[model samples]
Target chain A: MTTALTVETDPAQLCCEPSSQPVLNAVDAQESARVLKALSDPNRLRLLSIVKAGDGGEACVCDLTEPLDLGQPTVSHHLKILVDAGLLEREKRGTWAYYSLVPGALEAASARILGL
Target chain B: MTTALTVETDPAQLCCEPSSQPVLNAVDAQESARVLKALSDPNRLRLLSIVKAGDGGEACVCDLTEPLDLGQPTVSHHLKILVDAGLLEREKRGTWAYYSLVPGALEAASARILGL
Candidate 1:
């Protein structure tokens, strides 16, 4: 009876066999997740919005704190995360740091999610 | 010195004054982050891809585990997160549960990011 049951369990007969290969491979998934993780924070998203809406599509660290009611250090921390994630570019003009959206960064991120 | 410094500081002259309003308000940022957080996991992204490429754009929960070499419970947990984020829909057919991408859900998420 045990032998018969084992023989009857055909792999091809399984109902759950995968029908197609995933377009997003493991490596790409990890990279995509990293970008998404950086965007997972509320403050970070707000920072991106603030920067995007700023003069010339850029905003200074000093300018970010007031809108979010967050301390300079905290706001700077969030900006750094965005910079590291390749979503924002930081430029130092004089004594202040200005941040701008990396051109096409958001579009690329959106593509990653959709393409996956 | 205090009085002199105070007189020298002009709000309009500040380098950090925001030039425009953020398109993403705090409340909306929070909501967008929730969806992003759900997609931030590597496993979850892979799961989404698999479901997306599955037969008829759907796949059984049983078929999911083998691809990632993860157990059923873990896969199910990830799937639940996607469903709660409104990115995926789940249906039960007989003894198996199948998952598929929610229509326009990815596009909406992408829009949220780009619009911000």
Candidate 2:
């Protein structure tokens, strides 16, 4: 079952398996790649960093835009990308949107890439 | 110097500093993004995984191509990319080129992204 069909079609099926065992198939590679690509951007990475470095490990859009120096829309776009990628969780608090890193997103991605 | 010139012009300058303190600058975000982009590919991730899961935590090109189901040239191309990214080390032995994960490559990238 080392075909591309097994690898490209369903990523979640590839990595949702327990981590105690090593990933022995091509499917896992495809799935993990999707996650990595989502985190591969400079803006998205920075967004994650800001959120991770924020007080209580969370940040608002107002706080994030200042350090990024990008337009609010652009920062919002990047945050949306990270949120869509499942690496971040977004919540609207009144007029501002707050984002926080998903608890296990980084660790899960690390495990998938490192096979830990 | 929180301008784009400071962030985009040089990435190494952004993240080469120690990680004891939080990365509060835009430069750190930009440089760390470069490293993350380098590891974003499935082929590169798989290459790292195979090397990590190898007998001695290292693997040769001959061993990598089989698992990847990719041409030797493609695997070679990916290995070169990883090497260039400082995530892998290559040691040529006889007619074979062996690749191993550089120690701390993942950890550093993780620290950059997770701010840990």
Question: Each prediction's DockQ?
Answer: 0.62, 0.18
TM-score list, all predictions: 0.90, 0.72
Count clashing pairs, candidate 2. Answer: 0
Q: For model 1 chain B, where is the 10-residue window of minimal lDDT? A: B10-19
Whole-model lDDT, candidate 2? 0.71
Q: Which CAPRI category fits model 2?
A: incorrect
TM-score of chain B of each: 0.86, 0.75
The regions of model 1 sitting more than 4 angstroms off are A1-13, A19-21, B1-13, B19-21
Quantify all predictions' global Cα lDDT against the true fold: 0.86, 0.71
Off by over 4 Å in 2: A1-24, B1-24
> For residues A1-116, what per-residue lDDT tens digits would candidate 1 score against the true structure?
99878777854346755645566888999999999999999999998988888879988877788778888889888888999999999999887888999999999999988787
How well is each residue in B25-116 modelled by candidate 2, as lDDT tens digits? 55665677677777777777767777788768777666777666788789888888888888899998766777888898878877664453
